[model samples]
Target: MYRTWMRFLTPGPAHHRLGLVCLGVGLQHGALPTVGPRTLDHHVAVVISAGTGWYATPDGRRTPVTAPALLWLTPGVPHHYAPDPETGWDEAFVDFTGPATAPYTELGYIEPDRPVVPLTEAAAPRGVVARIARAARRDNPLLEVETAAAVHELLVTLRRARADLAPDGDPVLKALAHDACTPMTVADHAAKHGMTPAELRTAVRRGAGCSPKDYLLGIRLGRAKELLATTELPVAAVARRVGYDDPAYFSRLFTRRTGMPPVRFRAQQARAVPGGYGDRVPDPDDPPMIAGPRRP
Candidate 1:
């Protein structure tokens, strides 16, 4: 019968306005029966990590509760829930509120009508609850800030987990998008993820409608463009920064892809801004070359 509960008397004005605040956090194991066929003024998220039970609504509808599931209690909602007495469950919960809550509801992350959301895995949600509980235990100066941040993190974690479970979601695309800036060949990237080059290419094409090499090249060029437009870094330096050791080869590739040399592209962009490039001199020897039409 291990149980711990911590409540905040006042979360303060700062927490109230941040649009999200944690009012309390608790963990219960082998606890006694039902908590209310009544209503609450704030929201509470109960994560059931083990055991079985039932959650009932005001209209006599009873929903079965299982382990590794999220039971949401929305504000002012009439609800009653309890674990099986014979085999009591383990549960962790956090009460939270703020103006930011409405957006989450509208985004389908939280639903008032749907009280139970079965999680494929409970580790992340359990970890977040533990974090909130730990932060609440410490009577630190940044208690409100820390708790609010943790709550936001919890919401983000839930949303991401849901996204990962979505039928159309492709994690391979996400990995590529995040790691595109790294200097690695397509084969190397595939090998790192325990995927063959052909498999990686197929996944990338299906997810992003582009080959792996093309996707990586696009990322490199995009970064190069930003650097060229904003900084005074030399072409050779920009080339190295974008994983290209050969300045001449990089310049040719940039020209082929963008239809303009790096220097010309920079000058064109600089001239677009008012009072920009007024005293700057363009490199004179960098001639623009127009390729002939390709034969089919």
Candidate 2:
């Protein structure tokens, strides 16, 4: 029986981020006619769970596709692939791209030269694609964000799986670093990745030389500093912007971490630059005023 489901996302500014945006997701079953032998403008990842197929590249290179494998169709690359007539494959796919995509390529997660990647286990990839498909069906207000996040997770999963075969560094570290801005507790963050708090802490410490809580706090505080330096927002507003609820607590934490309050830091920054904080030049003759050592 032939069956196919696809969801194409509308473009939106909010979906744009350092990480990839999921442009579309789909699932297909049964043999299909040859698609492409043409080029595309965006990337597509096809995970084949069953049956067999063949994919052809722009340079006239044809690759045999078997079950339990992934086929990557890179942007602007001429390609064509189709399922076997006798044994049509079950395929799940997601299309995505962003500023972060190139880094993945450089990191060897995605390769243009090699189109087919065999999967030791197909269930996880299939589940993620199913999640994207299901979420796309809901058409939620946060669909873009949700799908984008799923795409990121999918890529991380692929990379980690590949890494396991070759024995690279821990993937949890990368996941933690990517999710640092979200206002979740370390335990919650750990749980999201199926790790206990203790396990997460140990992994993070081994990978980043700090506890997960400290890592998240550092990200929040850095954002808080940027807001204080760049905007005229109230202290409370800045605190909220960086995930703090109580202004007083944020102030105390800021003071504890930096050895000066947010207000004082802003004032010092403003004074350091002539005219205003936006001005690039500091007073040439003015001695640099250093804040006290940061708390451990």
lDDT, candidates in the order shown: 0.80, 0.79
Error of 1 at 34 (Å): 0.4
Best by lDDT: 1
lDDT of 1 by residue, 1-296 (tens): 54656566368886799989998888888854688988989889888889889998898888898887888899988999988878888888889999989987865567687888777667788899898877776667788888899998887666545422543447886677667767678998899889999999887764455688988889889888877887787999989988888999999999999999999999987433333223234568865344778999
**Clashing residue pairs, backbone N/CA/C < 3 A, model 2:** none
Clashes of each: 0, 0
Q: Write one digit per residue (lDDT tens) for candidate 2, span 193-292.
A: 9999999988876544467888778878887887788677899998887777889999999999999999999897643333323423457797556577
- Look at candidate 1 and give me any clashing residue pairs: none
Stretches of candidate 1 above 4 Å error?
Answer: 162-296
Model 1 residue 226 CA deviation in Å: 6.0
TM-score of 1: 0.58
Residue 261 deviation, candidate 1, in Å?
A: 24
Task: Estimate the TM-score of every prediction.
Answer: 0.58, 0.56
